[model samples]
Target: MSLLNGIFPKMKMTRSSNQSTIVSLADKEYKKDRPLVKMCGITSARDAAKAAEAGANFIGMIFWPDSKRSIPLPIAKEISRKRWFLAGGVNHMNVCEALSILRPHGIDVSSGICGPDGIQKDELQILSFMKAVHSVHY
Candidate 1:
């Protein structure tokens, strides 16, 4: 990631607790008040739809061949129903505070909802995290 960061110093790279990276190409038009929300580490269409229904601006499917969180192309195709990330250490517990304080144009999340083994995403946590994001209105 440092190498990539060196090459693209303008890009912001976020790494999850599990060491998986999520990179975001931010646009200047992003709104600080109603920021875009990106949910990463999605492996199922169900989760993708859930995030969208919860009002996520984008959903990211991991494609890194080396990461356990990476999904297969077919599954990725299926989840193309939604799209996009790269933020780290975000979860249900602290996301609200982060959003309220930083007021960023968009958010990137990943292992924030992963289970103890850091291999599987927790559906309940997903809900909690989304709900928290929704609760913070500007």
Candidate 2:
């Protein structure tokens, strides 16, 4: 019987579930002036270093258990720092969770944001994902 018990009755709460009002990258804006050069399918520390050196604005490391690209948290965190922004998973649901956990500059999703057999992107989900990204200041 906590203060938020009924308000979010079904919420699966965790230490990282709470939202913070403290915005850090408020001054920065996303611009195509410097394109979002992302390194997808980052598998190792070497790959992350290479992507960082290559001037990638983001690097994706899969966290989805089913994906071949998935890497351990320790390895992923090691690759992720102040340098290249880390993106996790190839699914929308996991991307959202990753956002809560990693707080990466950007998020990347493929299958979960798409329809069966990668037919098309779901507009609502895409918008929701983008909104989630915009809500947090990097």
Q: How does model 1 fare in lDDT?
A: 0.58
Q: Against the true structure, whose lDDT is highest?
A: 1
Q: Which runs of model 1 end up more than 4 angstroms from their true locations?
A: 1-86
* True-vs-predicted CA distance for residue 39, candidate 2, Å: 2.1
Local distance difference test, each candidate: 0.58, 0.54
RMSD of 2: 13.4
- Looking at candidate 2, the ten consecutive residues that score lowest on lDDT are 6-15
Write model 1 residue lDDT over 1-138, tens digit each, in one string.
Answer: 242222221224344587644433323344445644667777775675566556566665554456777765565554452124324567888778756654444466678888787879889888998999999876
lDDT of 1 at 86: 24
Candidate 1: deviation at residue 59, Å? 17
lDDT (C-alpha) at residue 4 in model 1? 24
- Could you estimate the TM-score for every candidate? 0.40, 0.55
Top TM-score prediction, candidate number: 2
Q: What is the C-alpha RMSD of each candidate to the true structure, in Å?
A: 15.3, 13.4
